[model samples]
Target chain A: MSRQDAPPIYLDHAATTPVDPEVFATMKPYFTEHYGNPASIHTVGQKAIIAVDEAREQVADFLGCKTGEIIFTSGATESNNFVLKGVLAAAKIQKPHIITSTIEHPCILDTCQHLEKRGVEVTYLPVDKEGVLNTKSVQEAIKENTVLVTIIYANNEIGTIQPIAEIGEIIKKANQERKNKIIFHTDAVQAIQYLDCNVKKLGVDLLSLSGHKFYGPKGVGVLFVKEGTLIEKIQHGGHQEYNKRAGTLNVPGIVGLGKATELTSKNRVADSKKQQKLRDLLINSILKNIPDSHLNGSNKHRLPNNANIRFDKIEGESIMLHLDFEGIAVSTGSACTSGTLEPSHVLLAIGVAKEQAHGSIRFTLGKDTSEADIKKVLEVLPPIVKKLRQMSPLK
Target chain B: MDHFRDPHNMGSIKDPDGVGEVGNPSCGDIMKLYIKVGKNEAGKEKISDISFETMGCAAAIATSSMITDMALGKTLAEAIEITNQNIAEKLDGLPPTKMHCSNLAADALKKAIADYKSKNK
Candidate 1:
């Protein structure tokens, strides 16, 4: 069959996911019918307040935190900025410091750069060739002035799962020896659907997650701030969110996020198992059928749904466009796609050469992925790669 | 996007009169231009055929295809005068970020003309 007649396949779930139907249904009523300002004390407004509270409880339940600890924000970017700027703004020490990994999302890295301009010291720790951070590096980077440690739980590009719990334990021990407590934060936006994220188990004082990452609505996120963690509000306005975040609630988006979180908690284990199998099938098939193709991240410690593959001679953007023409959606680590003229920082951090990084493509599965999707990819991808390689001059 | 999907005049000409390569693999764009030179009715040297092989983005491939179409059958002097803007205009304009891809395409054509001149000299 011609590619124009084929059904489109979505393999870029790491970028964003479509809202779950159940989550959408749960959010529908709040948009028009139950629409009221949560700040209002009237019966109509009180309903919105109740819905928002329930969402907080649902998110809190999933993360094993108290309901009061959940603070709703616009999304993970805001949540991440809130933690970095908020904590440092409230720090009592002179010249506060933060330790973060080099492979963190741009939200974290950019926030750290913005903070650095204002005299806050930041140490960006490096990762291994497999994109795994050594817990000892985190321990050694902590100093007397270190006030916070933030890291990404799972990378968006390569899908390498960092050792967050081990790093958290190292911070826990470090905090015991210091007079000033060092707060631990993690950007868990990409890990919420496939990993264990209970705050207590992870030893995290602050955590950030976005709704759209896990089959929920966009423009809504949660920042888990432990009771005793010191953080000043970044957005100053009203008395909402216990004066921690000062904005009217997004009732429908919160409802969707809550429903999505509840469903993820219920089906995470099964979903991970299914995606891992399909992901392995896709990765193994491509490696077997295509010559000079290499996997980008750690095979054992990577996310269940992610497969980043690099071709020897062809550029990633060309391959991505070819696959897109074949009715498949995917992403690339190449500078051409990002408009930045620089390759993915995560891939570069893992020591992938610039040319190899330009040749890498990322395929992330989701709860809806099946064996048929893997088969379709297997059928279409080999030919596409071969064609692009034929047109490539690198060889 | 159309040019990217089905590029015109792809691949190299065997024993071509001129060959020009520009950009680097590490920069995420490398275009190699091949040209066949022949005499026109007026006995002036003109391009008989042109083709390209590129390893880059959709913009890069599309620009390479567009430049080949724009330069084919033109005299080397006319081909060298085809600017990056002309290629982008023929392709209905590229994104600001992708303008550099068109530049690389123009540079490759210029390099090919230079190679042809050096060979005949």
Candidate 2:
């Protein structure tokens, strides 16, 4: 388990993934040789436009949507904001309300907070102990002026997959009952790589995904806006992305995204099966070997690659650093605020005690992950957890 | 990181003269420090024994271990005078973000000394 034995065994894929080699090769030409602004009308620009168009088609095909429905943005944050704010601003009513979960990404929660200051009412629905949103709660929270309902398809920290299609059906039935059009949105950034993302079957009006999560380059994402959905332009600039989003195209990143999307879509089933086997092995071995440790999130209906574990009487950051010294990479379920680290809001919302939240560690697998990597982690982890626990106050 | 591997003055001291418990709210870490008092030949009070238990990041545990090692066998005044900077320096300087761990260690030692003084008085 020494650093010299092998390269670092990375398990933080949920944060961001390395670009696939094929994706990099596809994007290489666009960066150097075919550099041109899509807005420009010349041949080089037309070439760039052609690439962007084909990328759009690739992404659209992956999502089972038409090309015109996909709008490229900087990333999921921008896409989430555009959908939340755009729909609110364009609503016919004087005051618009939004419904989102308590465990959404900060982009959605922070954006809701920002809009609330400007005369919008937001309802943050709570999740069950297992981090699953109850459809009955969503059904009861709908109001006449509720213009948008945005929820994450899979939680980043816990890896719990929300019932998107069921929630969609509930929203559709509510709309039919009240005759009020409430748009459904899901941040599918974590789901696009592994889950089936048929927009029609999911019954979502808008879906957001980031390129980096799917082995594509950073700074590129797609916002699938169902046709005829009323959304105002958030950025006021050039007339791109059907006048909904304004920015010059990122030709190379988009090309990379296209290839990444295509590769992931084709290999998802086999890759997920492999990752699931490794994930379960790591989980079972750790739980059996390590004392006083339990898994976070639901055992079933979770992402194939995620394993969030909590060790009693030990802090996750210490475990992460100890693993880092062993040339293994993992993530802690805590974020810094005002120069002090705080447990993740997602963990807190799921009824994990504040102190227990400090002990949460997340290990997310990826396409490149192998069984040997999982074995290496299992070998290094038990001793680290034991050592940290020996020094802990609770123990 | 090495200090984390072989921490000094860790665990609890039975029948301690003074004990201080501290918590870092943001990180949700708890640290407890114990001190046993003794009088030297010069008739000055000294930290006869010191140990710590911490539940936190590497820096927090290291600082707790560092502070106890720094305080053991030192005069009560000297032990209480050890600052967060000294603890951080002993650990080869912690990340700026983890500086609070050193602060928590210093505060725990200071409170232990204060508890000893008040109880004796």
Best by DockQ: 1
User: Which residue pairs clash within candidate 1?
Assistant: none
List each candidate's DockQ score. Answer: 0.65, 0.58
Off by over 4 Å in 1: A1-6
Best candidate (score: lDDT): 1
lDDT of 1 by residue, B1-121 (tens): 7788889999989999999999888888899999999989999899999999999898999999999999999998899999999999998889999999999999999999899999999
> Please, what are the lDDT tens digits per residue for candidate 2 over residues A188-273?
99998789899999999999999999899999998999998889989999999888888898999999999998998899999999
Best by TM-score: 1
* Total backbone clashes of candidate 2, pairs 3 or more residues apart or in separate chains: 0
Residue A128, model 1: Cα distance from true site in angstroms: 0.6
lDDT of each: 0.92, 0.89
